[model samples]
Target: MVTTNKEKDLYKKLSIQVSLNGLSFCILNRKDNKICYFKKVDFEKQLDPIKVLSKIELLYEQEEQLNQPVDEVALLFNNALFSLVPENLFDEDNAASYLKFNTRILKTDFIAFDKIGQDTVNVYIPYANITNYFFDRYGEFEYRHSLSVLIESFLSLPKETDTPKVYLHVHKNYYELVIIENGKLVFANSFEYDTKEDFLYYLLFTAEQSKLDPEKFELILLGKINKNSEEYKMAWEYIKNISFMGPFHPFTFEETAKPKEELSEYLLIKSL
Candidate 1:
């Protein structure tokens, strides 16, 4: 794990992000809306999550913040193990059977649920170690699909274009696409890709399948994508109006905090 910020001894609510190859933690002081503590550990390659999280728990074991009452922790899961079910037809009794169709259901998997948009509910797994750690410490907390936080926050923005707009939030090996039109959700899905060709193909294909002209539709890129990466170059070759997403309102980092741009929404969306 690489350390990025100086020590801040403030006690605050925790926000944790768990992914296939990494984990992040942020401490938020709600009274002043400040991000007092932040740390992100990116793995060189995929590691066993439970082992990684246990190591992480030890890394921060002495921090006073962990001792504080953290019943209000927010989780942003970064796996493909998530499904969006319509609220009207959502079956609590058959969640495992339903999600099995989209993603595999492991025996140790514990279902984490959250309400995303007005009509949809997200069923996802927060992985075993994450759930067990937070529950053991906080007793009760809230969880959300990492992608749902991005989409829900984006839809709250004022309408900007008459044409369809696609939001792509890229992570280590997956990306989320959300289409909006006239202030309503048009399409929302996640795609995983390994090569730049695969990434661009999914982006363009989704737009085309949605009947959105890649040349005309606007694309907002978020998460770990970089301007120097081939993913951006290939995407720019096909789509127009592609721009990086900005931070959520009312979130501030201390002069020394050095908040990460990639986790902007992940850090502040729960508060929003």
Candidate 2:
């Protein structure tokens, strides 16, 4: 646990998760892996590069201890962000060099998500799917993979011993749906979709191929969909027994220290 001058806190660590989709920053505690502060900065403003960096610095400046040498800095950026930079080519080397600290860019691995449960499908992006063209050269493939792995590892299953399970994952432009029966992967696939209807059609197609009773499998949806969101509504309309990517018992962690109303999406980093 890393304590700070603000008061003795439990953990001390910093991690930055940036996606081509958007930028997500988190100041975490290494002790319990609890996030102390987190915020997502959208690119809607089209700020200058210096301004972007300045915003990052300000974000870190908020923490008293964060001013010192940072132990690690992990970033996930879209590849295109660097394509236009002429001064410094923003490849993996440049991204690492730009961060300029003891940092490691995590590696993304395509692993079957279904290896964990029955009635559960395992999902993942196959390595063949990665393209240097679409994923900016400065992209963080490994970071995304690491985060997904962390979520999967952190979520526990006790009551789900005898049922089948499914694993789903979100990637650059595709979603993977997998089927697991009795702790083994049976069917797996990745498909691209442009609309919600497109996604639902694929889901129905995959479900038909699995040939299992829909009622036998618990539908686990991950990524970004709220209960009342259209995504969730569509999924539930199809499966009816849908559940979010649960992290077992997440409410136990009150480390964000914020009121429930102010909780950020970083909590979704864990599968729960």
Best by TM-score: 1
Residue-level lDDT of model 2, residues 147-238, one tens digit each, is 33332342444444656666555443446565656654555545666677777778777877787556667777665445765655777776
Q: What's the lDDT for all of these models?
A: 0.73, 0.45
Model 1 agreement with the true structure over 91-202: per-residue lDDT tens digits: 8877776588878788877887777768877887777777677666666666677767877887888886687778887777778888888887878888879899999998
> In candidate 1, which residue pairs clash?
none
Please identify model 2 stretches exceeding 4 Å from their true place.
Answer: 1-10, 31-33, 44-159, 169-178, 186-192, 247-268
- For each of the candidates, give the backbone clash count: 0, 21
Model 1 alpha-carbon drift over 4 Å, by segment: 1-11, 62-71, 260-272
CA displacement after TM-score superposition, residue 252 of candidate 1 (Å): 1.9
TM-score of 1: 0.86
Model 2 vs. true fold: TM: 0.52
Error of 1 at 57 (Å): 2.0
Q: What is the Å distance of residue 240 in model 2 from its true position?
A: 3.6
Candidate 2, overall lDDT?
0.45
